[model samples]
Target chain A: MKIILDAMGGDNAPDAVVRGALEAAKEFGVQIVLVGRGADILASMKAQGWDTLPDGVELANAEDVVDMHCDPAAVVKQHPNSSLVLGARMLAQGGGDAFISAGNTGALLTAATLLVKRIRGIRRAAFSPVLPTKDGHAILIDAGANAECTPEFLLQFGCMGSFYAQKALGIESPRVGLLNNGAEDTKGDPLHREAHQLLKRAAEQGTIHFVGNVEARDVPFGAADVIVADGFSGNVLLKTMEGTAMFMSDMMKQMFYRNPLTMLGALLCKKGINGIRKTMDYRETGGSIVIGISRPVIKAHGSSDDAAIRGAIRQAIRAVESGFCEEIRANIGQMILPREEEHAE
Target chain B: MKIILDAMGGDNAPDAVVRGALEAAKEFGVQIVLVGRGADILASMKAQGWDTLPDGVELANAEDVVDMHCDPAAVVKQHPNSSLVLGARMLAQGGGDAFISAGNTGALLTAATLLVKRIRGIRRAAFSPVLPTKDGHAILIDAGANAECTPEFLLQFGCMGSFYAQKALGIESPRVGLLNNGAEDTKGDPLHREAHQLLKRAAEQGTIHFVGNVEARDVPFGAADVIVADGFSGNVLLKTMEGTAMFMSDMMKQMFYRNPLTMLGALLCKKGINGIRKTMDYRETGGSIVIGISRPVIKAHGSSDDAAIRGAIRQAIRAVESGFCEEIRANIGQMILPREEEHAE
Candidate 1:
C-alpha cells in the first residue's frame, strides 16, 4: 500500500516529515510518496545523510506551500500546487491509498472534502480524534469539523465514529456515547436532545452500540469507545482537556524544581513521570482522522514531531487496510433516520 | 449583614453545614441564619459540643429536604418548606442579605429564580462559577443554567458576569470574553457569531471590557476576567477542566506511590505539591454564584467539605456587601443594547 505525506507542512515540516516518511517506509514496509518542492525535499533528505531516495519511497514535486493562516476555501483555487492540495489530488487519483497532512486543519479538511468528496450518503465529513483514557482510548468525533451541527449530523457522526473505532482501533461493536453536561436523557440543548433520540433509535436497530449520555468528567475514564458531540462542544472539551493537562504538567514540573530536595525527588521520580507523560502524549495516537470522506485522510498535529508523523502514517495504513469508508457507506443508511419521519416525531 | 444557610443540603448534611456556618460567623463576624429541621440542627450543634449558639447566629425551621434527584421545576410546589426553597424565601422576604446552599443545583437555581426573582430587564438568571487560574481566577458565566440561549441571553450573561467580576472580585474593569472555538470574529456557529457581534458592540460602548473571543485552552491562563458562553459549552468546558485536573492528580499520586523511591520523592516534595494543590483547589473559590438574581445566592458544591462551605459563605458575604445585584441593575441598561436597536443592527 502507498501513503502520501505533505512534506512542506507543520512546524517541523520538510525535515521531520521527510525523516518520518523514511522511518515509516523502512519500519512499516509501506511505500511513501512525499509531495512538496523537489529541491527542499532532497535537501532535507541529504541533511539526514541520505545520498539518494530509498526503495519503497518516492517524491511528487509541488512548488507552493500552504501556510497555517491561509484561507481554507481559497487554498484550492490559489495554491493549486501546494503540498496539501497536491497530496489530496494524488490520493483522489488513486496514486496513493491514503493521505496525511500536518498543515492548516481547515485547509486540509476543505481540500479532503472538495477533492476526495464525501461518501455518497454522508451529509458531512467529521473529524475524529482518539484521546487517551485510563484503561484505553476513546474517539471524540466532530472534534471541530462542523461547529454548528443538526441532530442528523450528530447521528452520522455516531455512525462514522463507531465504524472508525471498530475498524481502526479494533473495538468490536464500539460503545457510542453522546457527550452532554449530564448523564440523563433529559440533559443538553435542543440539538443534543434530538440527537439522543435519534441515536437511541439507531442503537436499538443495531446500527451502533449506543450508551447513554456520558458527561465530560466521565470521558477520561474510558466511559465509551466513541463519544459523539457537535464540533463546538467537542472542540471545547478537547481543547480544555489539552489545556488542563498542560497546566497540571507545568505545575508539577514547577513544584518539583522549587527546591533542592524537591529537585532530588524529581530526579528519583523521573521514570514514573515520563511514563505518565507518555500516556498523555498525542504522538501515540498520531492525529485526527477525517471520517465520512470518500478516502482516508489523517490530520496530524501541526507541531508533530518524527514519532507523531510515523504514528500518523501507521494510522493511515490501518485506515486504508480496514476499508473503514466502505463500512460507513454500507451502514450509514441505518444510522440516519429520514428527515420527514424525524420531524413527524 | 445576615446570611442564610441551607443546613440540610449537600452530601455532608447538617454536620458540615452547621460547622461551616459557625466558622463563617466567627471568622467573618457576620450574622448567620441556619435553615433546616430544627431538631436536626440542634442535634448537629450538640454533636459538635456547642451547647449554645454563637452570637450573631440563628436558625429557621425547614420541614423538608430537596434531594439531588428532585426536579428543579417541581421543587417549589412539592417541597415548599424544603431547606433550599425556604432559604430562598428568607432572602426574598429580606430576612437575610444572601442565601447559600449546597443542595441540588437545578433546585437551587429554580428556587432562587422563582423566589428571589431576576433583576429588572434580565431575561434569565445565569450560573457563574469562579475557577482558579494560575495567576488569579476567572468567572465562567451561564455555566449550567440555560442550555439553549438566544443572543440576547448571552449579552446579559456578559453584562452580569462583568459586573460580578468588578463588584465581587474587585476587578476595576473586568475583561469579558466570548467563549468560542477560535479567536477570530468570523469563527464559531451562528449563535456565537451573533453573540460576538453583540458583545463587541457592548464593549465599544464601554459597557464591558470585552476581550474578543477566548478559546477553552486560553481560559486556564487567565485570558479574560469573565469568560461568557452558552451553558452547554460552558458546562462542558468547566467539567472537562475538572476531569483533566482530577486525572492528572490521580496519575501523579499513582506515580508517587509506585515504589519506595517515588514515595520518598513524594514526601520530599510534599510542600510544593501542597502549594500547587491549594492553587488548583475549588474550595478556595467557594462555589458557583447564581448571577442575575435579585440578591446574592451562592451554590456550594454538593460534596463540599468544611473549607468549601466556609469559602462559599465568604463569597456570599462578599457578594452581598458589594451590592452585586444592585450594581447589575444600575448599569444593565448600558450593557444591554435596546432590543429594537439590536434587531435593527
Candidate 2:
C-alpha cells in the first residue's frame, strides 16, 4: 500500500513529516509519497543525517504552500498546486491508498470534499476524532466539521461513526451514543430531540447499536464506542478536554517544582507521570479522519511532532487496510434521509 | 444579612446542609434560616452533635421535599412547602437576603423564576457557574439553564455575567467573551455569529467589556472574566471540564498507588497535590448563581458535602453583600433587544 503525505503542512513540517514517513515506511512496510517542495524535504532529511531518499519512499514536488489562514472554498481554484490540494488530488487519482495532512483543517476538508469527494449519497462529511477514554478511546463525530446540523446529518454521523469504529478501531457492533447535556432520550433541543428519534429508528433496524444519550461528563468514561454529535458540541467537548489536560499538566509541573522534596518525588514517579501523559497525549493517538469521504484521509494535529506523525501514518495505514469507506458506501441506504434531498457541502 | 438554606435539597442533606450552614453562620458572621421539615433538620443536626440551633441560626418548617426528577415547572404548585420552593418564596417575601439549594436544577429554576422572579426586562435567567481558570475563575453564563437561547439571550448573558463577575468576584470592568468554536469572528453557526455581533455592539456601547471570541481551549487560561455562551454549548463546556477533572483524578490515584516508591512520592507531595485540588475543586469554589433573578440565588452542586455547602453559603453571603441583583436591575435596559418580543423562558 502507498500513502500520500503533505510534508509541507503542520508547524514542524518537512523535517517531522519526512522523518515520520521514513519511520512508517520502514516499520509498516508501506510506500510513502511525500508531497511538498522536494528539495526542502530532502534537505530536512539530510539535516537529520539522511543524505539520500530511502527505498519504499518517494517524493512528489508541489511548490505552492497552503496558508493556515487561506479560505477553504478558494483553495481548489487558487492553490491547485499547493501540497494539501495536490495530496488530495493524488489520493483521488489513486496514486496512493490514502492522503495525510496537518494543514488548515477547513482547507483540507474542502479539498477532500471537492477533489477526493464524499461517498455517494452522503449529505455531509464528518470529522471523527478519537478521544481518550478511561480504558479505551471513543470516536467523536463532526468534532467541528459542520457546526450546524440537521437530524438527518446526525443520523448519517451516527452511521458513519459506527462503521469507522468497527473497521478502523476493530470494535465489533460499536455502541453509538448521541452527545447531549442529559442522558434521557427527551433531552436536548429540537435538533437533538429529532435526531434522537431518527437514530432510535435506525438502531431498531440493526444498522447500528445505539446507546441512548451520553452526557459530556460521561464522554471520557468509555460508556459508548462512538459518540455522535453536531460539530459545535463535539468541538467544545474536544477543546475542553484539551484545555483541562493542559491546565492539569501545568499544575502538576508547578506542584513538582515547588521545593526540594516534591522535586525528588517527581523524579521517583517519572515513569508513572509518563503513563499519565501517554493516556492524555493526542500525539500518541494519531489523527482525526474525515469520515464519509470517498477515500481514507487523515488530518493529523497541526502541531504534531515527528513521532506524532508516525502515529498518524500508522492510523492512515490501518484505515486503508480496514476498507472503512467501502462499508459506508455499502450501507449508504441507512444514512440517507427518506424523502428529503439537501445541498451537500 | 440573612441567608435561607435548603436543608433538604442536595444528596447529603440535611446533615451536610445543616453542618455547612452552622459553619457559615459562625465563620462568615451571617444569620442563617434553615428551611426544611423541622424534625429531619433537628435529627440530622443532633446526629452531628448539635442538640439545638446555634446562635445566629434559625429554622423555618416546610413539610414537603423536592425530588431530583421533579418537573421544574410544577415544583412550586406541587410542592409548595418544599425546601427549595419555600426558600425561594422566603427570598421573594424579603424573608432572607439570598436562597440556596442543590436540588433538582429545573425545580430550583422554576422556584427562582416563579416565586423569586427575574430582573425586569431580562429575557432569560442564566446559570452562571464560576469556572476555575489559571489564576482565578471565569463565570460561564447560561451554563445549562436555557438549553436553547436566542442571540438576544446571549447578549443579556454577557451583560449579566459581566456585572456578576465585577460585583461578586471583585473584578473591575469584567471582560466578557462569547464562547465559540474558533477565535475568528466568522467561526460559528448563525446563532453564535449573531450573538458575537450583539456582544460586539454591547462592547461599543460600554455595556460590557467584550474580548471578542474565546474558544473552549482558551477558557481555562483566564483570558476573559466572563465566558458567555448559549446554554447547550456552555453546558457541554462545563460538563466536559468536570469529566476531564474526574478522569485525571482517577488516573492520578492509580498512578500514585502503582508501587511503594510512587506511594511514598504521593505522601511527600500531598500538600502540593492539595494545592492542585484547591485550584480545581468545585467544592472550594462554591455554587453557580442564578443570574437575572430578583435576588441572590445559588445552585450548589448536587453532591455537595459539608465543606462544599459551607463554601456555597459563603458565596451566597458574598453575593448578598455585593448587591449583584441590584446591579442587574440597574443595568437591565442594555440587555433588552430593541424590537424582538420573544417569550421569556
Candidate 3:
C-alpha cells in the first residue's frame, strides 16, 4: 500500500511529517510519497540523518504552500503544482491508496469532494471524528463539512458513521443518534423533526441502529456510538469540547501552581496528570477520515508532530487493510436509491 | 432581608439544608423562612439544636414536595401549596425578599413566571448562571428557558446579561458577545445574522457593550464577560461544558486511584485538591437566576444541599442589592420604543 503525505500542511509540518512518514514506513512496511517543495522536504529528511530516501519512502515534488489567507478554490484551481493539490491528485490517479493533510480544512474538504470525488451514492462527505468519553468514544459527523444539510443527508451520515465505527473502533451494530435540542421527535425544528422520522425509518429497516434524538449533554457520555448533526452545530460542538479541554488543562495547572505546597503536589503527580493529558490529546487520534470519498483521505492537525504523521500513515494502511473504502461504497450503493426528486432540488 | 428555603428540595435535602441555613443565618444575619412540611423542617431544625425557629428564621406553611417526575405546569397550578409555588408567591407578595428552591426546575420556572411575573419591559425570562472557566468564570444567559427566540429576544438577553455582570459580577462595561459560527455577521443562519446586526446597533447606541460574535472556542478565554445565545444553542453549550467538566473530573479520580503511590500523593495534597474542587464546583455558584423577573427569583439545583440553599439566598440578596432587575427593565424599556414599530414576525 502507498500513502501520500502533504508535508507542508500543519503547524509543525515538514519536520513532523518527514519524521512521521519515516516511522510509519519502518513499522507498516508501506510506501510513503511525501509531496512538497523538493528542497525543504530534502533538508528536513537530511536533518534527521537520512543520506538518501528510505526503501519505502519517495518524494513527489510540488512547488507551493497554500497560505491560510488564500482563497481555497482559486488557489487549488491556479496552483496545480501546490503540495496539497499534487498530494490529492496522486490519490485520485491511483499513485497512492490514501492521502493525508492538515492544511486548510475547507480546502482539504473541497479538494476531496471535487478532485478525489465521492462514492457514487453519497450526497455529501462528512468529517466525523470520535470524541473521548468516560464510557469510551462517540462519533460526531459533519464537523463543519457542509453548513446546510437535508434529512436525507443526515440519514446517510448515520449510515456512514455506523460503518466507520464498526470497522475502525471495533464496535458492532453501533447505535446511531440524531443530535437535537431534545430527545423527543416533537421537540426539534422542522429539519430535525423530519430527520428524526427518516432515522426512525432507517432503524426499522436495520440499516443502522437509530436511538432517537440525543441532547448535547448525552454526546460526551457515549450515549450513542454515532451522533449526527449538520456541519454548523457539529463544528461548534467539536470545537467547544476541544476549547473546554484546553481550558481545563490550563485551570488545573493554575490550581496546582497557586502556591509552593500545591506546586510540589503537582510535581509529585506529574506522571498521572501527564497520563490524563495524553488521553485528551487529539494528535494521537490520527487524522479525521474524510468519509464518503472513493479512497481513504485523512486530515491531520496542523500542529501535528512526528508521532501524529506516523499515526496518519498507519490510519491509511489500516483503512486499506480493513477495506473501509470498499465497505463505504458497498453500504451506500446497497442502501441509497438515487431519488429523482432530490436531484430536482 | 427574608429568604424562603424549600427544605424538601435537593439530594441531601433536610440535613444539608438545615446545617447550611443555620450557618448562613448566624453568619449573614439574614431572616430565613424554611418552607416545607412543618414536621420535617422542625425535626431538622431541632437536630441542629437551639429550637423555637430562632429570632430571624421562621417556617412558612407548605405541604407536599414537588417530585422530579411531576408535570411542571400541572403541579404548579394544582398544588398551590407546594413548596416551590409557595416560595415563589412569598417573593412575589413581598412576604420574603427572595425565593430559593432545589425542587423541579420546570415547576420553578413555570410558577415563577406565572406567579412572580416578568419585569415590565422584558418579553422573555432567561436563566443566567456563572460557569467556571480557566480565567475565573463567565456568565451565560438563556441557558435553557425559551427554546425558540427572536433576534429581539437575543438582544434583550445581552442587555440582561451585561447588567448582571456589571452589577453582580462587578465587571465594568462587561463585554457582551453573540454566540455564532464565526465573527462575521454574514456568517451563521438568518437568526444569528439578524442578531449580529441588532447587537451591533445596540453597541453603537451604547445600550450594551457588544464585542461582536464569539465562537465556542473563545468561551473559556474570557473573550467576553457575557455570552448571548438563544435557549437551544445556549442550553447545548452549557450542558456540553458541564459534561466535559464531569468527564474530566471522573478521569482525574480514576488516575488518582490508579496506584498506591498516586493515592499517597493524592492524600498529601488533599486540602489543596479540595480547594481546587470547591473552586470548580458549580454547586457553590448557587442556583440559576431567573433573570428578567420583577423580583429576584433563584432556581436552585434539584439536588441542592443546605449549603447550596444558603448560597442561593445570598446570591438572591446580591441580585436585589445590585439592582439587576431594575437595570434590565430600564435597558430593555429603551429598546422597546423603536422595536414596537419594526417587529419581525
Candidate 4:
C-alpha cells in the first residue's frame, strides 16, 4: 500500500512530517510518497539525524504552502502547487492509496473536496473525529465541513459515520445518534425534528442502528458509537470537549502542585493520572478523517509532532484497507429521503 | 425581600426545599413563601427539627405538582394548582419579590412565560446560566428555552444577557459575544452571520459590549462575560461543559483511589482539590435565571439539596434587586434588526 503525506503541512513540518513518514514507511511496511519542497524535506531529515531515505520512501516536489490567512474557497486556486493541494490531486488520480495533512484544516478540506471529490451521491463531505468516551470512543461527523445542512444531509452522515465506525474503529453494527439539545424525538428545531423522523425511518428499514436523539451532555458518557450533527453543532461539540479537557488538565496540575504532600500524592498516583492523560490526549486517537471523500483524506492536528503524524499515517493505511468508502458508495440509496415533497424545499 | 419557592419541586422536594427556605430566611434576613402541600411542608420542617414556622417565613398551600413526563406545553393548564404554577402567579401579582423552582425546567419556563409574561417587546425569554470559567464566570443565555431562534431572537438575547451580567453578576460594561463555530464575523449559519452584524451595530450604537463571535472552546477561558447563543447551541455548550467537568472529576477520583500512595497524595492536597471542586460546583453558582421575563424567575437544579436551594434564594434576592429586567425593558428598541429585508426571513 502507498500513502501520500503532506510534508509541508502542520506546525512541526517539514521536520515532523518527514520523520513521521519515514517511521511509518518502515514500521507499517507501506510505501510513502512525501509531497513538499524536496530541499526542506531533506533538511528536516538531516536535522533529525537521518542521513538517507528508506527504500520504500520517495519525495514528490511541491514548493508552495497553503496560507491559512487566505480564503478557504480560494486556497486551491491560489496555491496550486502547495503540498495540501498537490497531495489531494495525487490521491484523486490514484497516485496513492490515501492522503494525510496536518497543516491548515480549512485549506486541506477545501482542497480535498474540490480535488479528490466526495462520493457520487454524497451531499457534502464531512470532518469526522473520534472522541474519547468513558467506555471507548465515538465518531462525531461534520465537525465543520458544512455549517448548514438539510435533513437528507444528516441522514447521509448517520449512514456514512456508522460505516466508518464499523470498518475503521472495528465496531459491529454501530449505534448512530443525532446530536440535539434534548433526547426526545419531538425535541429540537424543525430541522432536527425532520432529521429524527428520517433517521427513525432508516432504523426501521434496518439500514443503520439509529439510537434516536442524544443530548451533548451524554456524549462523553459513551451514549452512542456514532454521533451525527450539522457542521455548526458538531464543531461546537468538538471544541467544547477540547476546551473542557484542557481546563480540567490545568486544574489537575494545579491540584497536584499545591504543596509537598500533594506532590507526593501525585507521585504515588502517577500511574493512574498518566492513564487519564493518555485517554484524553488528542494525538492518541491519531488524525481526524474527512469522510465521504473519494479516497481516504486524513487531517492531522495543526500542532501535530512526528508521533501524531506517524499515527495519522497509520490511520490512513487502515482507512484505505477498510473499504468503508466503498460500502458507503454501494449503500448510497439508503442515505436519501424517498419522499418527493421533501425535496421541493 | 420576600422569595416565593416551589417546595414540591426537584429531586429532594419538600425536605430540601423547606429546609433551604428556612435557612435562607434566617441567614439572609429575607421572607420566604414556601409553595407546596401544607402538610408535607410541615412534615419536612418537623423532620429537620423546626418546631414552628420561623420569622419572615410563610407557606401557601399548593396541592398539585408538575410532572416532568407530561407535555411541557400543557404543563400549566394540567397543574394549575402546582407549586411551580402558583409561585409564578404569585410573582406576577407582586405577591413576592421573586420566584424560584427546582422542578421541571420546561414547566417552570412555561409557567413563567405564560403567567409573569416577558417585558413588553421582548422577543423570547432565555435561560441564562452563569458558567464558571478559569478567571471567573460567564453567563450563557438561552440555554434551552427556544430550540429554534431567529437572528432577532439572538439579537435580543445578546442585549438581555449583557444587561443580566452587568446587573446580577456585578460586572461593569460586561462584554457580550455571540456563540459560534468560529471566532469570525462571518462564521456560523445565516442566523449567526446576521446576529453578528446586529450585535456589532448594537455595540457601535453604544447599546452593548459586543465582542464579536466567541467559539465554544474559548468559553471556559472567560473569553466574554455574556455569551449569547440560540437556545440550541447554548444548551449544547452548557451541557457539554457539565459533562466534561463531571467526566474529569470522575477520572480524578479514580486516579486518587487507585492505590494507597495516590490516596495519600489526595489527602495532602485536599485544599487545592476542594478548590477545584468548588470552582466547578453547580451549587456554588446557585440557579439559572430565565431572563426577559417581567419578573425574576430562577430555575434551580432539579437535583438540588438544601444548600443549593439556599444558594438559589440568595441569587433570587440579587436578581430581584438588580433591576436587570428594567434595563432590558428600557433598551428593547435597540435589540432588533434595522433592515426590513432581513426581517422577512
Clashes of each: 0, 0, 5, 2
Each prediction's TM-score versus the true structure: 0.98, 0.98, 0.91, 0.98
Which ranking of candidates, highest DockQ first?
4, 1, 2, 3
Q: Compute DockQ for each candidate against the true complex.
A: 0.85, 0.83, 0.43, 0.86
Point out the higher-scoring one by DockQ: 3 or 4.
Answer: 4
Candidate 1 docking: what grade? high
Return the clash pairs for model 3, or none. A10-A302, A11-A302, B11-B303, B16-B306, B17-B306
lDDT of 1 by residue, B214-234 (tens): 999888888899999999999
lDDT of 1 by residue, A144-182 (tens): 999988898899999899888998889988999999989
- Evaluated at residue B274, the lDDT of candidate 3 is 79
TM-score, first chain, each model:
0.98, 0.98, 0.95, 0.98
Model 4, span B1-345: residue lDDT tens: 899999999999989999888888999999999999999999989988998998999999999888678677898788899888999999999999899999999988889999999899887999988898999899999899998899888889999988888888899999999999888688889889988987898899999989899999989998899999989888989999999889888888998888777788788879988999999988889999999899899999989999999999989989989998888888888875556745576
Candidate 3, DockQ to 2 decimals? 0.43
Scored against the true structure, residue B116 in model 2 reaches a CA lDDT of 91
| Span of ten consecutive residues with least summed lDDT in model 2 chain A | A336-345
On residues B1-345, what C-alpha lDDT tens digit does candidate 2 reach at each position?
999999998999999999989988999889999999999999998899998889999999999999978878898999998888999999999999999998889899989999999989998898988899998999999899998989899999999899888898999999899999999999899899989988999999998899999999999998789999999989999999999998998988887888999988898789989988888889999999999998999999999999999999989988988988899899888888767443321
For candidate 3, give the docking quality class from DockQ: acceptable
Per-residue lDDT value at B195 in model 2: 90
